[model samples]
Target: MQTKLRSRTITKPRSHHGKPAQSLVARRLPAKRPPTHPGEMLLEEFLKPLGISQSAFAVRLGISFPRLNEIIRGKRRVTPDTALRLAHVLGMSADFWLGLQQDWDLWHALRSKQAAAIARLEPLRHVS
Candidate 1:
């Protein structure tokens, strides 16, 4: 099973005020909804289509069925160890799984109520 990954170079457009426009990441984020959880991707893209039972896949991954189920249900984050195991079994790079998890995490973090305070933080100026 080959998954085609596409890479693109994004050009940042400038606003009329000469400031950089919203980033590609920002544009892709849904306004009122969280992005697709990585677990959903794993279930939809790999497990169901491949007809792999959770118990069997968990055995193959050398993990417990509950642990695998938690991941599939989005109740658990895909850690580095899980990513590595998934890569070894799925033939995809660990980075792919980790990246999806990161994106999901960052999107939620940015949308939280504290995000406004985070945005207000100023960078320290360097002493030349």
Candidate 2:
């Protein structure tokens, strides 16, 4: 059976040190926004170093292979816990993961909001 995938939304905030707080995504601005999802980069980098398949990586991350696949495909959002776990497993800086996620969330949220706004404006265009 095909499972329904839900996009995850981050509500809480964290600190540079991984401390739980409010709006970490906001606190770390411009500089924190990465050029791309670090997880995707990390995943590729990690996979090369580990010499394992997606299933193996998923096992190491304590997530299902499909879920891991979703993350890689940009279909699923990465959570803080998952980011931390990745940092631990892949020997990457935890803050890097957090920054990537924060950046991804910010851009995705803004783009989505913009698209919705544009969509609303389409009907008005037809009426004009």
Candidate 3:
């Protein structure tokens, strides 16, 4: 008999913003939403604690210094591939990085001119 391996998904109980037991449906927006970039967390939480320099960490991740610098400066977004690299080196899951990027993007978008325009858009149909 052959054994079957299955993958499982684990959801975090708390968000980085310090909410506990965050529900999936009707996601709660933070009381005072501050768009925090992943780069800030990466620098303060990971790099600072690990004592890893930006240039050195870039070499460890097999990426260029300028690229890593941009990421650290919040000028660049962390893609899935970059998330994987970060996960490999930082001993964290790729989802963590992606989630950070997503949270920041959502918060930023909510305050953009495009969001105001989008608010004017009406729903196509009501299926309910």
Give me the candidate number with maximum lDDT.
1
What is the number of backbone collisions in each predicted candidate, taken in the order shown? 0, 1, 0
TM-score of each predicted structure versus truth: 0.76, 0.56, 0.73
Put the candidates in TM-score order, highest first. 1, 3, 2
The per-model lDDT (C-alpha) reads: 0.78, 0.65, 0.74
lDDT of 1 by residue, 32-53 (tens): 6787788899999999999999
Q: Cα miss at 11, model 2 (Å)? A: 25
Question: What TM-score does candidate 2 reach?
Answer: 0.56
Higher-lDDT candidate of 2 and 3: 3
Q: How far is candidate 1 from the true structure (C-alpha RMSD, Å)?
A: 6.7
Find the 10 residues in a row with the least total lDDT in model 3: 1-10
Measured over all alpha carbons after superposition, the RMSD of each candidate to the real structure, in angstroms, is 6.7, 14.4, 10.0
Clashing pairs in model 2, backbone N/Cα/C closer than 3 A:
13-23
Give the per-residue Cα lDDT of candidate 3 at 3.
Answer: 23
Q: Which run of 10 residues does model 2 get worst, by summed lDDT?
A: 1-10
| Per-residue lDDT of candidate 3, residues 53-104 (tens digit) | 9999999999999988898899999999999999998888999899888877
Give residue 117's error in model 3 in angstroms: 1.2
